[model samples]
Target: MKMLAATLSILLATSAAAAPGDADFAKGLLKKGVAFDTVKGRGKVPAYAAYLKTVLVDGGFAASDIAIEPVGETANLHLVWKGSGKKPPIAVAGHMDVVEADPKDWIRDPFTAVEEGGYVFGRGAGDNKFDVSMVIATLVALKAEGFKPGRDIHLFLSGDEETEGVTADLQAKQAKAAGVELLLNSDGGGGGLDDAGKPVGYSLSAAEKTYADYTLTVVDPGGHSSRPTATNAIAALAAATARVAAYRFPAQINEITRASLVAAAKETPGQLGDAMRAFVANPQDATAIAMLRTDPGSVGQIGTTCVPTMVSGGHAPNALPQKAALTVNCRIFPGVTVASVRGDLERAVADPAVKVAIGQEWVSTPASPLRPDVVAAVTKAVAAAHPGITPTPAMDAGASDSVYYRALGIPSYGVSGLFMKESDAFAHGLNERIPVSAIAPALVHWRALLTELAR
Candidate 1:
């Protein structure tokens, strides 16, 4: 019996020593290039899943505690560190799949993780892979430190989030069934930094705008371009599109956005700061709204925005087009229905010739309430990790899988502690990268947050 006990102690010590630090884990995952093809729905994701399993197992988590469920071409990795049955489990989630990257478009191969000038250049380095690595590193670090939570902590890594989010939706349902209480998603909110890389503030996203696409088409009989009729299809489509461009959705504010603006105003110095303060005090302030309109960064947070993304008209230069269409994509504010936005577009156009139809179904998700417990926990964590950086609740302009979990009645907040310059965030664009300085602080933030909430 004494020999068996000694062997178990040695095994535990070996597992604890084997856990890697946050930067090392991130480099390892980024090197795998778990790039997912939104169209084909496959990539090196299976290899990435195997990598995560190996890390967790090496961190001393039992094989039974980690479950890898395959869904189509991707898989979901769930790791549970069980605790006493006193509180519901808290789930930390990030998507494993990354958007496709072409080597020609990037300075270096997007799949290869390159460390240069205090930044990690890779495809998923910023979008989500860093967050996933942070969660894993934090959990492994906690295990190595011999810290035990009073409640279960579940790490959910979804395989499809940039495209279909099938795995996230499935896992959210599973988490709900397992009686998970709160979800801290790492894909949405984070710290915004200034030009000098100083922290502006950290945003905890409580809500996100809904995504809806609309198609406006004009149909007419084709004719010779030399003898074109007044009722040209292409011309009508162009006119309709112009009206949409000229139209602006009304500016609106909610509790979360109000707080965000208020926090931002405090940090800002000049007219921008004054404008933020005015808008927060009186959301109907036209002067402040006009000033904010000039700054693209501030405008998106205050109102629903619609813009024409795609347009196609003439088939031949010699003939009048028979049909012309434009795709209008809108990031809708919370609580607004897609039908209402469609009605607004139809009214704005006011022409019977152009037909506006829904290109995709709107998925509605209610905004998460700013629960005091969550706010306090996040605030405390931010204070510990980043002194003097205020924690502000925000509403994200882009949609995330958190909406699905929010729809399921589990309030999910985006609490990623990464701080980076807005100009450096090339997510879904060319040559994505993350600051090396941002990584260690993120690990500290996650560790502090998990300890605060679960312990």
Candidate 2:
């Protein structure tokens, strides 16, 4: 029990390394994907989908099996690889869209992939594109090698995952109607390498936090700035935001978090490790709670977190603002309702003048149960690809396309193939990139999964 569960398993499992395919081709696909600028409102996702379709078709997939549906300026791609099995289709979840990136803030053009040192630098090089390219390449290779499956395999690529999830929402409905067995999301959950270039371990996300946004609004009669009243809207809004900021959601524990924390304790050092063990043994330990609260990485694991992300007021420089609003975004823990979090925010402000409103319709979902088939297959595939790395099950804090699928009562797991060091991750930051060397084993990973699960 001194080492983490998966960490201990990782050390016990050693095997021959997995064989790779044309990694150079996969790298080329990733670079070409980076050039598309698939951010929202760009009207480029359909074009990107077409390029992928060409690759798949040329590699042996039938062209008629792929459909590109335009949703507003963006699009969704759905592909079906038919089989003879009686079981429902297995789905692979991915997104073509990238978060908005400003080229001025980066050392290289965010849309242009540049290979420097041993990495590829671009806006989406690491986040979803890296594994996305690998998945596509693996499928193509399977088709070319005349590999067939017992059950139909579906690949769904959403167009607006970084902004609105309209595409994923639509895909989830269609997948449910068609009776999709489960989804393997490439958006989150993967392995981490320590600074020494040694594999620490891998994590497969069986659960995730819910994403919701709330607005705190205050309105007042406009007047001259020099004659501002005590009820200035901006001042009242700021105070309300401050209260919500200072308030902390009660510490909570679940099956996934408890296991994840137990694993983290073994790798963590000093007082943090001590606190992790203490909190695991007793969730009500005040000293452990206080110590864990001091760490941002550990704090969110213990509770729902709400923070003011945007605030605006004052229309004119010479006049008092007539209205002001604070936009607070929350990553609600699983099993917590959105309305309950809204209630908490309103109570924290405790001001009649300030109004808290849910900005959109969002649903909180329960964690997906750990299916034995999924866990065993992932463990086997990872051991084959990474040679000694055992994947850990976790509940990630970020929301992904899996959220929609999981909400619809479908089991979804994050099984991204790309693995890298913690420092190499820059999914939404400047100089965003990923190592070029990750392509081969990633190819092996996807191929192995499809071989076992689909076959």
Per-candidate local distance difference test? 0.84, 0.88
Q: Per-residue CA lDDT of candidate 2, range 315-397, in tens?
A: 99999999999899998889999999999998899999999999864557888887888888898889888999888879988
| Poorest 10 consecutive residues by lDDT, candidate 2 | 12-21
- Candidate 2 matches the true fold with a TM-score of 0.88
| Pairs in clash, predicted candidate 2 | none
For model 1 the local lDDT of residue 453 reads: 89
For 273-318, candidate 1 gives per-residue lDDT tens digits of: 9999999889899999989877887888888888999999978989
TM-score top scorer: 1
Candidate 1 residue runs with Cα over 4 Å from true position: 1-42, 193-197, 225-230, 269-271
Give the TM-score of each candidate.
0.88, 0.88
Candidate 1 Cα lDDT to native = 0.84
